[model samples]
Target: MYQYSPFDRQFVQLRAQQFRDQLERWERGELTDEQLLPLRLQNGWYVQRYAPMARIAVPYGEISSEQLRMLAHIAREYDRPDQALLDSAQQTQDVLQASQPGLTLAAPPLKYGYGHFTTRTNVQFNWIPLSKAADVMDLLASVGMHGIQTSGNAIRNITCEALEGIAPDGIVDTRPFAEIMRQWSTLHPEFAFLPRKFKIAFNGSEEDRAATGWYDIGVQAVKNDAGELGFAVKVGGGMGRTPIIGSVVREFLPWNQLLNYTEAVIRAYNLYGRRDNKYKARIKIIVKAEGQQFIDQIEAEYRAIVEQDGAPHTISQAELDRVQASFVVPPLAAANLPSKTDTQSKPYQRWLAQNVRAHQRPELRVVTLSFKRVGWAPGDADADTLDALAQLADTFSAGEARLTHEQNLALPWVHASDLPALYEQAKALGLVQPNIGLLTDMIACPGGDFCALANARAIPIAAALTELYQDIDEVTDLGPIDLHISGCINSCGHHHSGHIGILGVDKDGKEWYQITLGGSDGSALSGAALPGKVVGPSFSAAEVPGVVEAVLTTYRDLRTSQAEHFVDTLRRVGHDPFKAAANGARLDAGHRTRQAAETASA
Candidate 1:
């Protein structure tokens, strides 16, 4: 993890103070609500359906145990509890009112709850008060973290592989470059106000874990002809009302020129991007409208900057060394590891199969502590959970943890010998779902329940689907699946990239769901050059579960073998089969309704 320098700490502190002043001015009516809107957005504050929400960025998804503890503190102090507590007397009174007078409740009051993790690799507190926003900012800055530029028409957090430094097949450790961009882009006065929000992602590993193909500016680390390290730059990728896979702009760009090249690209977009319509203001729209001409303009601008001064294009060797040094993995003692088959516990075996991944170091492993539990929202965690995780990190994972774009936590450096103990601890914390890549492991956004912009509720649909797939054996039989749900067309859940994507929409003032099949985050890299397409007409929310089950059943019956993943099979056969399956399920549901009505009449 990159430690904050004195300058960095002071800068964050000053930003917090500025926000405090702005908040005071707004409270005093000196600044209108409209005036405070942009300011609050720049600071990652949003006026949601219920209350103000603050999104705290976790840069590159890396954090120390101390930082987790601080976040836990904020959750306890500022955020609303997930469940309201009742005193013993109140509980008894409620029971008596319910006509269950004999029922006695626990005496102790439960601890307060807090925030939820986001798919963007950040934490969001949805019920924050506007008055406490400044205090939240100060608390975050105190721990060298901030929500600056997390929202607004500026470059958002630069995301990368969660296991950046430890991926075995990675071409380069991407954290250094990600951190460099983070520092450079933070509060860049020139690009502060673009046509729309910009997102940049880098992927260093052979596996594209960061969904690079769906970002505004996506870079894949690759080796050039001379075996020199560089990036393969792709621009225009995004998802929303219009989802687009980014086009390749540069086959190879030297590592040193990354900053200059990115700056040039964004500058061109800033100059040429559409601003008249907020809906179409994204860079992807510009790319679509201009085609090759867009790339030509960017190249021309990049050349001009390069010719003007080589200084800005060059990253000093010393600076690179310093950033690289900050990410050094801690030493681990050699322990004779237990054999994989030694554990007869089915839960342990299931956990190992799902949550564990091979690490760069042979003796160490990466464990994904899943947050996708049944009945609970997929990505939510209370203050107590965060604190528990911090303790686990300190004891077993070198006091460091990484948050994943999949809305889960990653312990990046646990020894093989520590697996049993860690697994036990995780089970106690209710973090051992053993469904990392299964059907129940769905990604969903806080839809109508929290966000003001949502068309319908998303979390309930996600929960229903998760419950539908509760039989782990049946889910295992169904094989690897990526299910994603979004409240609206914003695609915050990356629904466009899931093998089975569900988008909540409003039809005649009723909630409906549109389903798409064959989407995968790795599709572009895996030779499928297109995003997922819709299967059929949007269905009512009540029909979603059966429709989804039918789609999975279609895959199971049609796939050549179990080894064929859902996306691969769907792509090979096209969406016709899944569409037919969904249609059949809908028809059956209608027939059942008619039969039930006829029986009631009789």
Candidate 2:
């Protein structure tokens, strides 16, 4: 984790103070909603259906135990219960349930406040009041965290592989580069606003866990034939009404040129990206429109910028050394295997198999803490849970934890011998789920329940599917599946990259779901794949669980063996079979409805 220097602390405090003044002015009626909208948005504040929502950034998904504790304290202290707020929450939850009949109610047992993790690996508090928003920002700054650039048409959080430093097959630890980008892009005057919001992701690992291809900019750390480290820059990738896989603009860019090249790309987009129509405003749109010409323009601009005396290339060696030193891996316990008596329990074995991974160091391991328990919304943790997890991290993983782009937490350096004890502690906190890569371990967005942009309810749909596959044996039998849901086309849930993608859509005034099959983010053995293709007509939310079940059943029947994952089978069999199966399920449901109606009439 990168420690904040005194200068870094000063910068954050200055931003917080400025926001406080702006908020005060707004409260005093010095600014209208239109005038205040962009200001609040850039600071990650939004006025939602019932209350205001505040997004707190967790940079590269790394947080110290102290920072986690601060978040817990913020959840408990700042968010007090209000009857009106509760009523609004209930109303939203009701709408979610209406779309998905027979779904379990998703209202968690609340105290003062709740925090939900987002696909960007950030946490959002939905009940934040306008007056309290600035206070929350101040609290965050006190702990070297802030929500700046988390929203609006600016470069949002600079994300990278959560397992960057520790993944066994990782080519290079990209966290240092990611942190450098974050510092440079934050409040950059040139890109303070843009045609639309931009996102950037980096991955050094062989497996693309960071969804690099679906970001506005994707940087893959690579080593040249001479063994010198550099980057492969991909641009124009994003998802929304238009989904695209980023094109490789540069096959190999020297590591020293990272910042200058990034600036050049954004500068080109800022000058020519669509501004009149928000719908077609992403850099991906412009990249598509211009094709090779766009890359040519960026290359020209990059060369010109590199010629400047105080260009991005001026970053000092001393600064690089300082930043790298902050991320040095801590010493680990001596190697020791756990005794059979400690690991023989069935539940322990299952959890270890699902949530734990081999570390590069034999004495250590990486453990994923699952947040996908039944009855709770995916990616949600209460204040107490966060507090307890923070304490556990301090004791078990050297006072730090990492949040994955998949919306799960990772204890990156748990000793191999500490497995049983850590599992027990995590289980007590309900963070142990033996389905890390299975059907129930699905990725979902807040959807209609909380998001103003959502057309349908994603949370309840995810909950219903989890309940439908309560049998662990059934989920495991289904094999590894990536099921992702997004409430709308913004693709916050990265649905386009999932094996089975569910997107919520508006059919007239009703909530309906559109299913896409045979899509993946290129994790297949072949290294070639396609984005999900929509099946047939959209189905109602109530029909989603059954439709999903039908699709899974089709996969199971068609797969040659359990080893053939859902995406591979879908590729082999194509979407026709899954579409037919979903259509069949819909027909059966219609027949059942008619039969019941006829019997009642008789």
TM-score of each: 0.92, 0.95
Residue range 470-523, candidate 2, lDDT tens digits? 898888888788889999998888788777899999988878889987666665
Candidate 1 lDDT tens digits, 1-602: 78778988999999999999999999999999999998999999998765688999998899889989988898888775333322442453234224311112211222235667888888888767899999999989999988998999999978887988799888898889998988898889867999999999988987777888888999899997789999999899999999998899999999999999998899889889888999899998889989998899999888888997654757878999988887777655433333434366888898999899999989899999999876567788888889999998887788889998888999988988888888878888889888888888889998765678888667767767777777888888777888999989998888898888999888886667899887768733334435678989998766788899899999999899988878878878988988999999888777776787788899
For candidate 2, report its TM-score. 0.95
For model 2, the superposed segments whose C-alpha errors exceed 4 Å read: 95-112, 308-314, 331-342, 524-529, 598-602
Question: Which 10 consecutive residues of model 1 have the lowest summed lDDT?
Answer: 100-109
TM-score of structure candidate 1: 0.92
lDDT of 2 at 345: 76
lDDT of predicted model 1: 0.83
Q: Rate the local accuracy (lDDT) of all candidates.
A: 0.83, 0.83
